[model samples]
Target: MDATTLNSQAERFLAELHRSPQTVRAYRADLRHLTDWLRETGHGLEREALEAYFTVHPHWASATRSRKQTTLERFCRWALQHHLLDRDPTLHLEHPRLPPPHPRGLRREDIERIFAVIPPEQTRDALLFRLVFETGLRIGEALGVHVEDLDLTRGDEHLTVLGKGSRKRTVLLDDPRLVSALRRYLRTLGYTHGPLFQATKNGRGGPLRYQSVQERWQGYAGRADMACTLHQLRHSHATELVNGGVSLATIRKRLGHQHIQTTLRYAEVSDSTADAELRRWRRQRH
Candidate 1:
């Protein structure tokens, strides 16, 4: 197959992917990688070439391999259906074994360090990161929040978020500091509509893309000299609530977890938190 012909088919496949723009971008990047490798090796898109590609990437973790494999499989299937290829090379490819779920929660002190490093002038980023931390919101959910979804009434302040599976849930804004910061952000942003977090590059208040959000968070983390990730902030929130004796049902609802099992994955209490619980229990016994 000609490289130009392959790229054209890949572009069509990505355009028709019709998933989230982020998902399409991921597939495009993966395909681009494969195409670049093919160009260097002078190999066609076939089973042997695909196998050789995976063989060279021995450093790829199972999750990374799995995601890339999925991208390739989807593209190959589309190519076969369009008669661009004779067969699906990825059909017989072995799936990578993903590791067990391990939710990591940053300690309060580390979280503090991360926040402290943010310059006082970048209130938008400071508020965005804090919102995810305090509310246990997935980065996507936090980014998807629209201005209209916020209900900052005197007594009750909450925001409706579209979580995984397109399920909508209301996240309570009980932290006084967070609420105060959010209010200040709103005053700074005079827009009465559109995404709560916007892309500064566009100047039209367009929704911030996921890749940009991840890169920006990484930049802040690097400045703090910490390795904290955007998603870890969400885990830190759930772990905080769990250690504070919050009910699993409540945590599940707040995090918009469709199942209690997902919430349970992050319910591990720290040693200090467990010690505090035991001390409280002893005091109650007296």
Candidate 2:
């Protein structure tokens, strides 16, 4: 009914949901936007207030509106269940239909071109790019990796990555090129401890910042004359696996995707695959 009530309930709802910090921040932002609108219009937490707000902001993008709607519905349900409200304001709310995701990634040649620019002197930076590309790791997961997480001595060499929602998954280090590069990097460092990628600011070391990673990636992208982002390396890795006939289930586990549907977005057909499939289909028909 009020901003204070909404904020407190949102915190409880997010905690009960066991949402990731990133998700919690997003939900808080969405709630703030709605609460601000309510205050400006002198409205309360009711279905009429929500619909009126929606009516006022007709130009809001579908994705933005959809997120707000979900936040509102979630809050309304929580309020009703807790007897904070007489009825659910979002009982008759409609969910927006979102379009299917088409994830874009680098081709094999593109990856090669980007790697060409990183010289042997920058082994640390090169290793960073290779790790993310080879492992299909989110930047956060890759940065969070510790020295102990890498198991290079054992058979089926792999590294452990802590993914979204604090889920841990093993990423195999099967590529000879990547494996060799990692070995060289570790040898050069002459020590096997602490963060896999360490950042030193004012003589203190810690995990690398996301902004630092992005800036480094952009620098490499510019030198290589390519348009890419650190996140795109992950997409490129997934695309490569899918095109190589890797199973969806294996890809899902490797990428640490909670849902197979998220992995399915990478099932996009490459130009070569499309051509091959068409030729095969025509031959079978004939």
Candidate 3:
């Protein structure tokens, strides 16, 4: 088949893959790389050309190689099914191996220090950070929050969050202090309905752009001398829950993660607990 035909086939296959938009974009990017490499080598959309390209390429790191391989594999699978190729060229391609390591989580004191650095004049910024840290919300999810999402009534104390893939989940706001703070902020803005955290002075709430939020966070991090992103606040909340003895499954559900493995990364065992476990193992060996 021609190169244009092959590229078209790849796009159709990707559409059929039912992957997320982000995944589809990455696959398209990877395929473009392959096409570019082929053009440089004066090779067409044949199996021999693909093999020649891989033979000269240096070994890539685990993550990078895996992503490239995945893109090719998907393309090959689609090609084979459609009779474009008799066999898959990427079937024998090797992906780099990686070692498992625990995810980095912030200490409770570090979290406090982050909060302490927020300037008093930037009440909105402070509340944004606190809400994300306390709720374990993804930046997009937090930005998507509406004023009606927060319920501050005596018995009902929780926020309804719309997470990735349009999934809705209710996360508890058990801290009365946080609730009070949120209420006070809301009162100041006079936001009774519509988007909760909006970009406005008259309180006619409109969507708060993510870039503005990120820029504000960077400034806060700079002043505090802390290495933090909006995501770190989410990590802080998840780590706190895991260390406080909350179940992995519960955390996963609360965080609206489709897989349990995503939640497992957030688990942070205390150093003392790790030491005790090591001693117990040593005693057993003895």
Candidate 4:
């Protein structure tokens, strides 16, 4: 088919894909680039032509090529369904292999040093960081916390977190220091109802946006010379818990993970610790 016809078909196919707006825009851009190449080379939308186009385009990185291939594959599927094409061009496209996993975590001293750098006036931000690190909460979950979710009067010393997929779970904050920090922050804001951490203008209260929290974290990290992201705080929390002899099942429930496998990724339990636990269990049984 001609370039104009192909463009029209691609647009319709993307509309039918029902992907998120950002994803749709990206796919559309990739397809447009492919279409331009096809027109310039006077090549038809055939499998051999598509392969040649990729082979000739040395500028595309492996990851970019993979994403483009995925886009074209989806488009080809739609085209085949609509009889726009006889066969899929991207059926045998190879995806780039991802690199090895590198776990990012902060040592206890690093955490302490970062917190110490926070000025007293920015206690709210510091406490927010502490809450995420101590509770293993996603940034969204921490930002979504409401005043009612924190039962400070409860003797159990835990906070109710509304986590991913709107799942509720109780995450313990066993450290009295963290609890006190939270209480002090709440008192300073004079926030007794609704959201616990609200936006403020010269100490006047409003709703806090997640992006604002993220920017604050970036600024704090920059100032402290700490090579860490906010999400790493969650990792630190999980690592600390795993090292402290907390069971995987307990951590799973506390972290509000739907799957145990998801929780297992966070458990950085040392081999020595695992062996010791196994020996302890065996001795008890004997």
Cα lDDT tens digits, model 4, 78-102, are 8888998877777776667755454
Tell me how far the alpha carbon of residue 161 in candidate 2 is from the true structure, in angstroms, after superposition: 1.3
Best-fitting candidate, scored by TM-score: 1
Q: Candidate 3: minimum summed lDDT over ten consecutive residues — where?
A: 94-103
Judged by TM-score relative to the true structure, which candidate is superior, 3 or 4? 4
Top candidate by lDDT: 1
**Better by TM-score, candidate 3 or 2:** 2
**TM per prediction:** 0.64, 0.63, 0.62, 0.63
Candidate 4, which segments miss by more than 4 Å at Cα?
Answer: 1-103, 271-286
Please give the clash total of every predicted structure, in order: 0, 0, 1, 0
Candidate 1: worst 10 consecutive residues by lDDT?
Answer: 199-208
Q: Write the candidate numbers in order of decreasing TM-score.
A: 1, 4, 2, 3
Better of 1 and 4 by TM-score: 1
Ranking by lDDT: 1, 2, 4, 3
Candidate 1's residue-wise lDDT over 1-286, tens digit each? 6566778788888878879989998888998888889888998888888899999999998998999999988888888888888888888889988767798999979988988988999898899999999998999888889999999996799999998889998889999999999998999887899899888885566778999889988988898899998989999999999989999999999998888988889998989988999999999999
Q: Model 3, residue 96: displacement in angstroms?
A: 5.5
Q: What lDDT would candidate 4 get against the real structure?
A: 0.83
Full-model lDDT for every candidate = 0.89, 0.83, 0.80, 0.83
